[model samples]
Target: MRITLSDLNTKDLATLVQRTITTSDLGKYAVISNHPLLSELKKVYTEYDAVYTKSTYSGKGTDVASADRDRDVSFRALKNFLDGYRKMPSLSNYQFAEDLYQIFKLYDLSLDKMSYSSQTAQMKKLIEDLEKPENIQKLNALSLLPAFNEMKSKQDVFEQIFAEQAGANANLRNMKSASSIRKDLEKALRSYINFITVMKDVTGWELFYADINELVKAAKNSTVADHEKK
Candidate 1:
């Protein structure tokens, strides 16, 4: 019944809130349906979702955050693929996986902690390292050349959009960040969960608690799976 909600990333947090709403409706839990907290949850969820969907760029430009996310995913997928591939002795190219994986270990792994510009610089250097002839040969042996190419593509796209909006971003007003909005939505969810925990013994409240608790568990499991996959 316990879920460490704060541990979830942006994507999974939205999924948790969304699935909770859907589950509450599916069971037709009047206790939840009538609650003021449910209304508040819906309101905050909408606000947070809209903020991210509509990029921070005031005019027509691609979202820098999304492109950054794609690059991050692509890199992690390559790293994780090597981690698994290197462990398989049966594969003739397993030696290549082990060699290329050493290249990744040479750099700092916490790309997300860096500022956006710093992250871009770091990715560019990493891509340069990966595209070296020695690394390219090993990557080809493991059939991972395309994965590196895709990561480079995402990095290139992010770099382009970021440069395009650099001047305009300075002029745009400071808007509420998606992270801040998410905190408000999470608070609404906590209030609803707290109320149900207190009232579950009441006539029709038990089922509502069960349904939402299950959704909470599911979200926790999903987050675990995502991390493991990476």
Candidate 2:
């Protein structure tokens, strides 16, 4: 819960904020949702997201790297899940997993080892193969549709960010730097987190407080992991 928002680069910071507000069921309860600080957090995030979209160059390739890493993890999740599930011969899903694993095997993408460009290209084709009606049915049968959707979403986002990286002709003259907008967002985020920390013992706010706390802890651990890698 002690994440230093400033230490995270643009992509991670934006992702952290987005997940906090959007994924934490912030609007599920009117009582929690109507808080002044919650509204402020949303306002700040809207500006942050818009500014990040317009200020793509501010990431200095770090955003693309982050997107690529996300794609890698998601892709492997689908693959590794199928691989392991297929080994459980006694399970009802074993046959389904085996079928899905065969589809993955056909591609031989080896995404983790490929260069960024190469991996992206291969992933595009693999996703297309997955889209076949037969493959889709098998994935659904094995309860893997959500995982596949997540992997596809991450890939699509990575592709979009990758395209933005080479957009030198983009008109950035009037755009605020993502870093500057992020500072505003960081301020609002800290204020909101502080409020939640205090309100966590209250009845209605406990669920959101727990979810946001977990997100903050994950982000903090990820930052530490990133530092360790360096």
Candidate 3:
């Protein structure tokens, strides 16, 4: 069956892109025997293979690296691959895939690289905050009410940011801005926002906290009632 872009999920798309690139690289390597660039390509491909093998053995197989370190390394390898391919005269103008593949592949890799970088930075902040005794105590004592309230506020902010940025991007695309050659970016970002919003709603902070509070209260009440009867 022919797989269209709309048919593939995020993971599937990522895998498709990685496979396309890897296959292209291998084909070029085969054709360009005794090429000086072969050594570097082999080294990079070896690293990619190692990462792929490790993830498979761990039963957490993913095409795009999910972990921060591995993701960074994979992206670097991809970039190196692209750069080397550009330098090869023989591979020039070799059509690997259609424009959709070109656009989405670049978008996927670039967006993921940025997203992972941001997430890594955020994790560092969270770790720093958690390491502080006072902050840890404060977090430990967090009640359902305050926690949910804060989460709700943050959710609103996140939604607003997404909307504004999306609108601006759409406008830019419509205006045919120099940087707006990739029209699919706007669509991708919109879809991403929808996905994130649905996820947040499904895993709402308020609802989870309320459920935990109800469970704790029921346990406490059961204990007290048993003691009174005794």
Candidate 4:
């Protein structure tokens, strides 16, 4: 369901933050923890609930004038509302984004250890299988391969081809020599690098958020918007 951040309770908001932290790669986490925008977000998240409660429930201090009290109340509400915006990207696409992140991590962390080149025939079969409508449908349903650019989608397709090919190969059913493994690893690495190269414009949280935002926007402008129009 489409949701705005203000729609979530403290518990839900915290879950979103936790999901982001847990799913992120080290590079992504660095951005979340260190970037000025995201650092401020973490701070606001830590204190916003308490501040919202105080602003809404507590009376003005005795020394405050009535006019100033109203102004202060307005300002607090506005600030709290703005803070909620931080949760929007997560609320919209955390689950799919997590899946995509997992796929990337599988390649990033484990790619080098793979052994697919040894079973060229089986690897080709596996790639063909992945190209089937059913497998492609599954990925499409998750909205993992956004058309941010043609190159991004192409990278996704090729990476999946490499991964599935490796996994499906009978010869690679067991581990291989480290030197033998390097062949498949290098292949995977090349695909991964190509994918990241296509995405060179952004990195870390910025890149992560862009993926979700683009997918969400596409959905909203399509069926979601159409439903609203009707």
Clash totals for all models, in order? 0, 0, 0, 0
**lDDT of each prediction vs. the true structure?**
0.80, 0.81, 0.38, 0.39
TM-score (all chains, Cα) for each model:
0.49, 0.48, 0.18, 0.22
lDDT (Cα, tens digit) per residue for candidate 2, span 105-146: 877738667887889878888899899998899899888899
Q: Give one digit per residue, the lDDT tens place, for model 3 in 108-127.
A: 43433465446444433433
How would you encode candidate 1's per-residue C-alpha lDDT over 1-230 as one tens digit per residue? 56677788888888888988787777477666646777788889998887756555566254877777888899889988988999998989898888877777665566755778888777788888988898899998888889888998988888888876776665443656777887887788888777778887899988878887888888888888988999
Query: In candidate 1, which residue ranges exceed 4 Å CA deviation?
Result: 59-172
Residue 39 lDDT in candidate 4: 46
RMSD of 3: 34.7
Strongest candidate by TM-score: 1
RMSD of each: 18.5, 19.6, 34.7, 34.9
Q: Which scores greater on TM-score, model 2 or model 3?
A: 2
Candidate 2's C-alpha runs over 4 A off are 1-59, 169-230
Question: Where does candidate 1 have its weakest 10-residue lDDT segment?
Answer: 53-62
Give the per-residue lDDT of model 4 (tens digit) for 36-82: 43443444444443332232212322322333333334323322332
lDDT of 4 at 220: 37
Model 3 residue 223 lDDT? 50
Give the C-alpha lDDT of model 1: 0.80
Better model by TM-score: candidate 1 vs candidate 2: 1
